[model samples]
Target: MATLKQVARWVPSHWGAGHLVLAGFLALLVLAVSPVIKLDLVVNGLFLGAIIGLGAIGLSLVYGILKFAHIGHGDFMTLGAYFALFLLSDLFPRIGLTGAGLGPFTFGYPLLLALPLAMLAMAVVAIALDLGIYRRLRRRGVNPVVLAMASLGVAIALRGVVQIFWGGGTEQYPRVSKLFYRLPMDVRIPPDNLFVGGLTVVLVVALYLFLTRSKMGKAMRATSDNPDLARVSGINTEHILWWTWAIGGALAATAGVLLAVSQAQLVPIMGWRLLIPLFAAVILGGIGNPFGALVGGLIIGVTSEISTQWLNPSYKPAMAFLVMIIMLLFRPRGLFGAKD
Candidate 1:
C-alpha cells in the first residue's frame, strides 16, 4: 500500500480528481439503470474493454519508444484479422484441418493454430514497415509530423490492400454459436467473452512481468524513458525499437482477432473505425503509459456501453471522444502521466 501511494504521488492531483469524477458519474449511471440491465451492459463493456486495452497497450508502447503517432497501426490490425481469416478459412481447409468449434466454444484447433501465426506475421509486417519506411525517415532526421503523415499513407495503402483482396464487404470467422452460461446474479455470458476476458488478463500479467523482470523489457523501458541516455549506457536502442514494433504488432493482432470474435463480423473499415476510440483510450490513459491505456480502455468501454441507454448506440465512439475531452480539460497529462 505504501508503494502504491508513492507511485500515485507521481500523477498530478487534477488527473486523479478527474478520475474520481468519472467514477462518480459511472456509479450514478449504475443507480439510474435497472440492476440486471446495468450488469449486462457492464459485462459487455468489459469484453469490449479487453479488446481496446490490448490495442491501446501496443499504441502506448510504440509512442513511448518511437515518439510518433502510428496512423497505420489500425490498418495493421485489419491486416492481422485478414491473416487469421486466410489461415483459418483458406489454408487450413486445404490441409484438411477445418476450423471446427471446440465444446461450448465458437472456435477450435484451427483458430488456436492460426492465432500465433497471425501474430508472427503481423510482427514481421511491422518490422518490415519500420525497416522499409520509418527507419529511413528516422535516419534522415525527419520531423515527427512527417513520420505521422507517412504512417497515414501506410494506413491508406494497407486499407487498399485489404479492399483489393477481401473486397469492401464484411467477413467472419468460421464458427458456431456457444451457449451462454448463467451466473449467480442471473447474468448470462458467452464462452467467447470469458475467453477474451481471461486471455486479456493473462496477456496483461505477462506484459507486467516482462516489463519488470526481463532484461530486454527493462532495456525497452530505459529506451522509452531516455533513448539517448539508454544508448550511451550500452543499451542497443535499435534492437529495442525492433522489439517494440514486434510486441506492439503481436498485441494488435490479438486485439483484432478478439474483436472479430466478440462482434462476429469484420469489415475493411473495422480497424479504421476503431482508431478513434483507441486514440481516446491512449490519451485518456496517458500518452505513453501502457497500464494507463488499459485503464482508459475500460473506462471508455463502460461509459460508451452505458451511454446507449440514453444516446444512440452509434454514438459509442463519440462517448469516448467526449470522455477524452473532459479528461483533458481537467488534466491534459492523463491519469497516470508524470509531469514533463
Candidate 2:
C-alpha cells in the first residue's frame, strides 16, 4: 500500500507521464488477457530476454560511454560460442571429460570451463579493436558518424572471418539428446534455459550493486555523464573506457554461449541475426541505461512471443522493431533515460 501510494503520487511531468502511460498500458493488457497468458510464452520470453539483455548490457555500455554504435559487438557473441565449441568438441573428451552436461543440460562441464577463456579472449579482442581502430579515429577528431561507419565495415569483415573459420553450415554441441521437461501448466522448461536465466539474474544484480557501490563502477557512470568533467576530477577516462570494453565483451561472450546452449546449434551468422533485436533493446531501454536493457529486453521478448497470437509467428523478429518505432514516436528518451 505504501509503494502503491508512492507510485500514485508521482508527478506527471513529460518524463514521468510516460511511465504512468506505460504502466497503464501494462495494467490494461493484464486485465484484458488475464486468462490466456500461456506459461510457455512467459518461460520462453524470460530466457530469451535473458540472452538478449545480457548482450545488450555490453552494447549499451559501449554506446553510453564511447558514444558510438558498435556494430561489431554482435560478432563477439558468435565468436564466443565458437570458442566454446572449439574447446568442448573433441578436445575435452580427448582430455577425458565427456560432454555430458550437468544433469540434463545440452551444455556440458567442459563448455562451462571454456566460458572464462572465451570471455578473456573477447575482452582482449574488444580492447584491441579500440586501440586498432577507434582510438586512432578519436585521435584524428573524426565525427561519430565516421566511427559508426567504420564499425559497420569492421562488423562485415569480422563476419566474413568467422564464416571462414567456423564455416556457414550450422553445428551442434557434442551431440546431446535429452528429454526436455514440461511443467504442469503446459510450460516447458529446458535445463540449460533455466541455468542461463538464473545466471543472467545474478549478473544483473551484481552489476547493479557494483555500479551503485564500487569506486570504479561509479567512475564509469561518472565518465558516461561527462568525460571532460570526469577527467578534471582525477578520474582516468581512458582506463574506464578500457574496462567498459572488458566488461561488455565478457558479458557478450557469455550471452553467446548461453544462446548456443538454448538452440543446440552454432552458426557463424547466428549473432548477425540477433543484432537488430539487440539494437532495439538498447534503444528501447534508453541508449545508456543498463537497467533499461533489462526492462526493455523483457518487454521486447515477451511481446515478441505474445504478439504471435495477433500476428504471424514469422513476424516475431519485427516485434522489437515495432516497439523501437513506437518508443521513438513518443518516449524518444526511453523509459529510464534522463529528461533533457
Candidate 3:
C-alpha cells in the first residue's frame, strides 16, 4: 500500500485537483448568469433534478455495489411507469376504482396505491434479471465491459417488450385537472412538481438513514467500499446484492412514476432519452456515491434548463452530454468520488 505522504502527494497531481478548479468555474459561471436565470426555470429545474436524482441514486447504488454499468436501468424506469399504468388504468378500473383525482393532484388514490406495487414488481424483475443474466455472466468471470454490454442487450429487449405490449405511442395515467401553486418571483409550479420534489427528499433521507443506521444498509456500504474485504468479514455479499437490486429497482419505479405524472405522458423511449442526463448526474456526482448523484442531478437539471436562455430548449440533453464530457476529460472521478 502507498504511504500517507505519497497518497497525499498524488492527490494534487491527479485529476482530483481538477474538480476544485471545475467547482470554482461553476461558481463563477453561476454568479455571472444569476441575473438572467428566471425563477420559473429554476423551479422547473428542481423538479427535473428530483427525477434525475431519484433514478441516478439507484443506478449509482447498483454500480457501487456490483461494480458494473447497468445500461438497462433506464429501460427499467420505463417498465415501472408501464407497470403503474397497468395497475391504475386496467386493474383499478376492474376493482371499482377508476383512479379518480385525489385532491389537487392530477392522479388518484389508485395511483398512489399502484406506486408501491409497481416498485415491488420492479424489484422482482431486477432480481430476476440478475439471477437469469448478470449472475451467470459473473460466474463466468466476464469483465465489467461485458456486463455493461449485456445490459445494453437487456435495454433493447425491455424496450422492445414495452413497445410490443403498450404500442409505440405515448400513454399516461388517468388525468385530472392540474393545479399550480404560485411562489415568489412569479414562479408557478404544479402540485405534481412539489410532490416529486418532496418525495425525492423523503426517499433520499430514508436512504441516508438506512445506510448510516441499519445493519443490512451498513453491510451494503461495506460491500460497496470493498466487496472482497466485506465478504471476508463474514458479510453475506449475496444478500447485499439482493438488497441493492431491490432498492435500485424500487427507486427506478418511483422515478418513472414521478416523471410520468409530472410530464403528463409517457412513451417507450422516454427513459432512454433521460438516460444521458441520468448518467451525467451519476458521473458528475461520483460513480457509486448516491448523495453525489443527488447533488449532480440538481446541478445538471438546473444548468440544462437554464441553458435555454442561450441555447434551444431542444438541446437540453446536449447540456448534460457536455457536462459529462467535461468531467471525463478533467475529473473522471467526479466531485465526491472516493479516492483509491
Candidate 4:
C-alpha cells in the first residue's frame, strides 16, 4: 500500500484534473448506455471504425505533406477496389493462381494474391498524378483550390474509365458469405471485417514505429512540419513527397479492399459515397493528424453505426456530418490535432 501510494505520487499531476474528469465522464456514459444498447451494434461499430480509421490515416498524411485537400480521394479507393477485383476475378483465373485460402475465410487464394498488387498499382497511380498534375501546379505556385478542382477532374475521368471497362454495375470477391460467425454476445461477426480490424491495428502500429524510428520517416515529419525549413536543413522535400503519397496510396488501397470485403460488393461510386465519412474522420481527428484520424474515425464510425437504433438506417452518414459540424463549432483543432 505504501509502494502504491509512492508510485501514485510520482505520476503526472495533470491526471488529477482534465484527464480524470474526461475519464469519469466517459465511464458514466458507458455505464448509462451499456445496458440499453445491443452488444452486437457496438461490435459492428468498432469493426467499421477500424476501416474508417485506416482510410482517414492516408487522407491525413496527404493533407499533412501536400497542404491541400484531395477531393478525389474517394475515387482512389474505388480504383483500388476495382483493380483488386480485376486481378482476382480475371487475372488470377487467367494465370491459374487459383487455390484455397486460409480455412474459415470466404476469400480464396485469388483475392489474397491480388492484395499486394492492388496496393502497388495504387501507389504508382498516386505518384503519376503527382508527376503529371500536382507537381506542375506546385512549380507554378498555383492555389490549392485549383489542385482540388483538378482532382475532381481526375476523379471523373477515372470513374468514366472504370465504367467503360467494368461497367457501372456492382462487383465483388468470390465465396465471401461463408465466413460469418456468431459470437457469445449474439453478435454476427464477419471474419473478413474482423481481419480488417486486426490488419488496421497492425498497420497503424507499424506506421507509428516507422515514423518514430526510421530516418526517412523522421524526414517526412520534418517536411510536414515545415517544408521550407526542412529543405534548408538539407532534407530532400521531393523525396519526402514521394514517400508521403506512396504511404497514403498504399493505405487507402488497403482500406478499399477491406471495405469491399466487409460489404461483399463494390460499385464504382462506392468510394465517392464514402468520402464524407472519410473527411469527417480526417477533420475530426484534425486536418493532417494521423493518430487523431484513428480516434476521430472511431468516434464518427461508432456514432454513425449505433445511430440506427433511433434514426433511420439511411441517416448514418448524416450522423457523421452532424458530428463534424459540432466539432467545428467547438474544437476546431480536434481531439489531438494541436499543431506542433
The residue ranges of model 1 lying beyond 4 angstroms of the native Cα positions read 1-37, 184-186
Put down candidate 2 lDDT per residue, 99-132, tens digits, no spaces. 6657777666777788888889889988999999
Tens digit of per-residue lDDT, candidate 3, span 12-119: 565453576486558746854577768788779879988999999999999999999899999999999999999888888998988656888888888878999999
lDDT of 3: 0.89
TM-score of each predicted structure versus truth: 0.91, 0.91, 0.91, 0.90
Backbone clashes under 3 angstroms, per model: 0, 0, 0, 0
> Model 2 misses residue 100 by how many Å?
1.9
lDDT of 1 by residue, 198-284 (tens): 889999999999998999999999999889999999998889989999999999999998888888888989888888888888887
- Residue pairs in collision within model 3: none
lDDT of 4 by residue, 132-173 (tens): 989999999998888888888988988887899899988877
Residue 302's lDDT in candidate 4: 79
Instruction: Write the candidate numbers in order of decreasing TM-score.
Output: 3, 1, 2, 4
Q: Which stretches of candidate 4 lie over 4 Å from their true place?
A: 1-33, 99-101
- 2 Cα displacement, candidate 3 (Å): 29
Alpha-carbon shift of residue 67 in model 2 (angstroms):
0.4
